[model samples]
Target: MSQPEHDAYAASPRTLEVEDLHVSVGDHLVAVSGVSFQLRRGEAVGLVGESGSGKTLTCRAVLGLLPETGEVDRGSIVLGESDDRVDLIAAGRTVWDRVRGSRIGAVFQDPGSYLNPGITVGRQLVEQLRVRGGLGRTEARERAVGLFTEVGLHDPAGVFQLYPHQLSGGMLQRVLIAIAISCEPELLIADEATTALDVVIQAEILELVARLRRDHELSLLLVTHDLAVVAETCDRILVMYGGEIVESGPTEQVLTDPRHPYTRALLAVATIGDWTRRTLDVIPGQPPSAGEEMPGCRFAPRCRYATQACVSAPVVTTEIGPGRSARCVRLDELDTEPGAVLVQDRIEATA
Candidate 1:
């Protein structure tokens, strides 16, 4: 059999490299189109977008949890040591089973869902360690307890014995963190893991994650709708829209000087600058339905400066140098809006 065309990207030291990933929800609905990015060990990669912009779905793909109908129609995700990069997209369940939850740990949107209400936290963590590390029961328990203490959970012994319903959201999330890193996994994926918690708790979790990454030398893939979170935590950011990455750069650069309309729109609406503000700039137009076919650019309907040229021209990655890139037809001419504006209509959907 011949090698897939995109395999040339396999040997980089990057812990994770997702290239032109296309995932379809079903026969017709494409959830992610041409998404690509890489994560080096000890670095953080953030994916930011509005609800339904495919941020969460992209992370799900990394964990091999695509909807039953969902198919990774194209792309490659290479993870592992040099010269031995494992292809995440083409790999079957057995391959994913070994790599996921072990080599690539994840913490999802709700820690509540992560814990089984009937099981004690210790059981969950110990079981996870045993499964992933192939440790004996005693060894797994010891490591699980050690992990609890490592995350700064006081009275780790007592907390380990409690069930999911017994601990506060923050505590449970911390336990999930313990499970995620117990194997000393090379990568950690956090998908809006703190969304359900309060701000103070969210900051704690974020800080804990950052600290753990630093202490363990782990790569991080952070997926969230919160740009503020990206600004505070991630080194590099990837902005997605209608499935594809529309812009990417150093987190600071993208936040302060976004070049794409979509990225600008995202920053414009951020309430981050004013906590007392009552309203946010709401972008108009619903995201195209999964796999909904379209003839032109996916973001065209909501873009302010779109023209006939944009209607037919495929959005391509335009380099902004220093690792920054934007997908736009008029990158230089875009009117930078520091704040979000409400766009109300599709007006003309075609050129």
Candidate 2:
């Protein structure tokens, strides 16, 4: 197979910054706590973690698309460049309307859930064009057809007239991508956009996304659990566990030299081949429940190298390398291969 083509975007001063964000459902259950990250202009940052690790919540908080019951209690989500930076947490509906679909578009995990069954694809795309681009009906219709063609749809007019139900999963995903890039957003958030599709279709969607990012000069936040998927698409990786970022760095650096036990465990299972040729290496214990107060390291319960300090002391963000950080109390004592502890645990279990 040929290598994927890359497209570079023009340099810009804009960036998306999330600082000390805390999101909660109702009053008690905090879904995302003290999570902070930054995406520079035209950068693809992959947010990876198991489900319930607060990946989707962080994306929703940035877009101000959190459910009615969910609220941002602490921290600010700042967008745009230095002089014109706007805090999304304080932005009103009018501001969000102007920002979303225009400056910041999102492609959700499921197209069927977001796309209306009764509406024609053309009508939906035209609505976005009219609202975001302030175009007339004829102009919007023309733009919609162009978008359909751009996203690789065969018959623009035919696909435009069809309802959501009329298209296949891959087709619907392509339509969603078309809609997302309709207004040419500076930042595109794809939350598990290819999870539901088969392997072949997922590759196609990812390739399309790569092309779109280059052509449009868009910064992408790809939320996914598969480390391998992001390895192929993202520049940096942010590993989250128990609603907190446990480690983050350049994609290759983090994937090849993981410092946190949680990150190592996640990478161990995200493999195409298992050397053991037996049971796959799995992380023991479940994630803590939402709003559950963790006194020390959130992953200590399942960590083999965990000790008294890990169970009672605060897990400080240790600087493992330049621009790389890991939240683990025993970072200095950790071995190069963190998963070796898993092997030791199994041997002890069977002994």
Candidate 3:
């Protein structure tokens, strides 16, 4: 069957548009190339990919936390607001200092790595609350305690006094989340925020986030590879491959009826429908190094349907819905299925 064209995205009351964005790691490496998407208020958008697909980098760019070596080349992050469309990329440090943690909060992959081992957990939360969230010292401390309880922590006062090294990975993660969401920012970026936690903790965290977003009318940009997380938490999905978006649409649409070739393989491997009948599912080929420039579709080397057309086809997305799109050569003929042979059976190749 032919795939639906991009005009099919569901209607939403509010939106955050990211248009033609680019991120560079240095003089030569461009991590993400002209990426774009819309995130609605009180909704979740998942950018799905492996580590180097530029998911984290894109999130950091939004929060003004990109590494010194990394830079946002050009783009528009149109955050819906009462007045003034905030220009994140062109904003000054003073503007960023005001916006970063106050208007935008980030829950990164490693909470332990970010939390200061020397400081007590309570002190860190209180300080951030006072400085960014705009509470007095006493009020911030109380708010900190409130956040712990909100996140399902017991003995919140005792956990506050605990040092980073004294807590388990899950505890530290929850504490970090409390700090991130303490201010109730309009946007939240969760870059594998649940990675270190066990299954129970992960599920709890996801639920907590979903609840909070709905209650507070928050927008979330979730970067995760776990397909289940996408199914449960996100309304829409953006599939990233080799520093560009390969496919995106409503989560269900993209999952059940994928359009792009890369999207097809991802859905095949992740679909819950009939995985029981197949052996292990995997996508073949090591991703290309962004350090070197390549032409055409980046996933073409691994895509089963690739022909010569993909070799030089500049990466571009065809519209399938209001906010759904993808960069694939054979969008019309794409099919979601298990490969004839194991994707693993093939040798590693790059486009």
- The residue pairs in collision within model 3 are 5-320, 6-319, 6-320, 6-321, 7-320, 7-321, 7-322, 8-321, 8-322, 9-322
Clashes of each: 4, 0, 10
Tens-digit lDDT string for candidate 3 (14-80): 4467889888897748899988887877889999987688888888777778899998788977666
Worst 10 residues of 2 by lDDT: 1-10
Off by over 4 Å in 1: 1-12, 335-351
Candidate 1's TM-score: 0.91
> How do the residues 1-351 of candidate 2 rate in per-residue lDDT, one tens digit apiece?
011211122233557989999989867598888898888787899999988999998999889888888988899888888666888778767787779898898998789789989899889999989988899999999999999999999998999899999999999999999989998788999999999999899999999999998998889999998776887899889999888999998787787677898887886666532334466656778998789887899888888788988888667777676557899988888877634434324334555
Backbone clash pairs for candidate 2 read none
Question: What lDDT score belongs to each candidate, Candidate 1 first?
Answer: 0.82, 0.84, 0.79
Q: At residue 21, give the lDDT of candidate 1.
A: 89
TM-score of each: 0.91, 0.90, 0.88
Q: Per-residue lDDT for 148 in model 3? A: 89
Question: Model 2 Cα displacement at 185 (Å)?
Answer: 0.7
- Quote the positional error of residue 151 for candidate 2 in Å: 0.7
Candidate 2 differs from the real structure by a C-alpha RMSD in angstroms, to one decimal, of 5.9
For candidate 1, the 10 contiguous residues with the lowest summed lDDT are 342-351
